[model samples]
Target: MKNITPLQVAILVALATAMLVAGSAHALALAQSRVIMLSLITGISVLAMVYYAINYFIYRKIKLIYKTIRSTKTLGGGEEVYSMNEDPIGQVYDEVQQWSKEQTSKKEEADQLEKYRKEFLGNVSHELKTPIFNIQGYIHTLLDGAMEDPETNLNFLKKAARSADRMEALVKDLLTISELESGSVKMDWENFDLQELLQDVFDSVDHKARQRGIQIQVKAGCRAPFMVRADRKKIRQVLVNLLSNSIHYGNDHGLTQVGVYDMDRHFLIEISDNGLGIEAEHLPRLFERFYRVDKGRSRSEGGTGLGLAIVKHMLEVHGHTIHVRSSAGVGSTFGFTLDKANG
Candidate 1:
């Protein structure tokens, strides 16, 4: 009765009043029969009064509950409803609370997605600006008087070409990463000699290493014919990117070492370099696309900053893990584990 709406209360009151009137009329019609009729009329009025009193009390209680639910302090500032009894009201309250929680979770996820989107755009803009600015500056210089100055024109043209190549490489890597992230890059997996695959990367980058006066060495603890199941082309790209980065950042006469070891449950490969090691803060974000520790140095060395990011994604596709260890001025080591060869 306390939970009844205004309409229900009005109906109850009207019915009670009608019953009282009917009782009174009956008493008048039975006036010839004195005592018993009077007694019945009194009893009927008393019962009606009792019913009305009870209904009024229930109505007040329901009004108090409604007020409580509407107040800001109902649950002690908590988002969820707090009630002691397992009544219908409490069940409805619980459902409302669950809905609120789900909405909150969705809102938080949306905020995080928006933050990431902004960050990605900012990084892309920075990456593009570097090469684009360089190309524009060099082209303008070449047009002004560099063309008449053979040495100067040749230098400017060479630098411009390098910048263009970097831009092209960055675009290609971005596309590759997009395909990987969107689950559109299909992997062709087969059993291949891991050592042989690494050798190919060494051969591909060997000339660049020699030109830079850097030594690229590979040491395989495992036998030469050691085999693992992986996507050969994708894995090759990963190794090439890492090796290229090592060479690019290494000192003029620095050492770049590649080691392969079988660790029973997994095959571990480590590529280490005595180069301009990454700072502690930058190490964690090394695999983030377009993240650069030294913007000038990275551009001068023709790095797009997408190499390690692509390496990470390619490894992820093969269900592998990669980790990096570095000191600011010392050197850096990157190691990854591939699934063990099937027995």
Candidate 2:
């Protein structure tokens, strides 16, 4: 019943015609041979006409519909591109329904992606505009009457320089992230002491942390050499970004801690800070490029806004994931895993 064929329809119609022809001849008392001959000829002729007409018109149209529906994906390959015995009309209905669903899902995803792209572009424009405007205004003032005032001229020049520096940092971070996403940046992997790297990062960021009197510490017993296999330079960059983040948002005279733990096959490195942490809603998008919290002067304090994003990508390329835990007013911890060095 689900698979009624045109040929089956023709056979059923022919059988009914045969019975009708035989009954009419017998009612008129025609000869037995004449009745049988008439019935056979009528049945065969009807069968041929019906089968031929259906194939020529209805069946051909059905085939065209099925082809049109699948032509987009025909060259893509499938296990059974053609089914010989299936009902053509039923197949077309199923294909159309499935295609409709696929199109709907694809459109939804594209729309979401488009929305995200627009928002990202807007953020980039806003981030660059402030510094660019500041630099322009400062230069214009210095070129005008401010140049005659030595005291004011130097201050304007310094402000212009800072704005220019910010622009440069933003451009550099953008380029780094693009390269990381396009897979053009390769990791130079090596075995190194993770604790040693931590200390180095601490020393590097000491000058910045000192501005706020923040203490950067390694957790007790974690200062020892816990060797790890990773891109030492990239890992250093990650630690510096996280540590610097803590400093930017941490309370005056607050504390930042770095810890290392053994996770059987990998080492878990975490950076924790007693800072105004992110809210639950923002946590999901915290690592996104150009995403900023309302309270932090991340950009004003030399942040490029792409720090966390770059860190995420750098870890991802090494077959690892970064995790963060934070809430408003409380502290936050950012952790990522690295393969432990083989003994």
Candidate 3:
């Protein structure tokens, strides 16, 4: 329709048939010139009929598909231009199938995200409700003539204060995660002695570990300092969070150990403890916000339930990752990586 007419296309097809037969005869060395002439004439006649049938029936449908795809999709230069000389029907079919799969995959991911969002909101509300109710009850009791009794008043006030503190911790953790996700908190990167930092964290929590009769130490071979580049404060937070969690769950007279292993370009830090380990099923979602393996026990532990989530975010900001492993009665191990420091 644009440049070449249907008559011209038929003429070209006829000429191509003649040339093809002539070339075949020459290549075969058959020396059958009359045979070549008859073949060309018959081939052209058959080709004309076939071409008319295709153009009138099949070509219209194929061209329609091509046009529909063109109209719907923004075809960049990578897309082949539609032409009668080429069959693009197969390519179109494959592309359409692939597009359908991609859309389906996107929908699945969207549904998953939506589900997570609902769970997060519900978790936040549920977490806040307990402390809020406790505080409300304590204050109401104090106001209802318990204020006259110094013993009851003082005890209720202290309980109310603890509840308020729990709410404060929850809110702070929520802010920290929000800040981390929004990239509002910047990592201050530098080289630091990894072993030295671990000592500081242990000393800070020495009393808590002592109460459990649990000993905290670096693995035997990992006492020496491993220089690494990362945000010092954030890494320390990661250490404290993981180590404290280990101590809280550790068995009496058990051990919690930190290990640093040499990876080619990074150091892997693992915190392992002989504690009440998590179930296998909870491992996958252990890092998720407010996802507790033992919800009742976890709430009693006075944690905002965001420690692991915060640790994950802190390490991730330094382009690193953290992982955990556990067995029912054996122990749990958490591992993470950091870039090696330059000399």
Instruction: Give all candidates' CA lDDT scores.
Output: 0.78, 0.86, 0.85
Q: How many clashing residue pairs appear in each of the predictions shown?
A: 1, 0, 0
lDDT of 3 by residue, 1-343 (tens): 4455444566667777777777777777766877577667867785787578767776677768766765655434554554555544555677778666767888899999999899899999988999999999998988889999999999999999999999999998899899999988877889999988998999999999999899998888888889999999989989999998998878888999999999999999999998899999989988888878787777788875799999999988998888888898999999999999997
| Candidate 1 residue-wise lDDT at 330 | 81
Expressed as tens digits, the lDDT of each residue in 153-186 for candidate 2 is 9999998998898889888888888999899888
| Span of ten consecutive residues with least summed lDDT in model 2 | 75-84
Q: Can you rank all candidates by lDDT, best first?
A: 2, 3, 1
- Which segments of model 3 are wrong by more than 4 Å? 1-80, 85-92, 262-265
Per-model TM values vs. the true structure: 0.71, 0.90, 0.76
**Maximum-TM-score candidate:** 2
Ranking by TM-score: 2, 3, 1
Q: Which residue runs does candidate 2 get wrong by more than 4 Å?
A: 1-3, 19-29, 78-85, 300-302
The superposed Cα distance between candidate 3 and the true structure at residue 289, in angstroms, equals: 1.7
Mark the regions of model 1 whose C-alpha exceeds 4 Å error after superposition.
1-85, 141-149, 220-223, 340-343
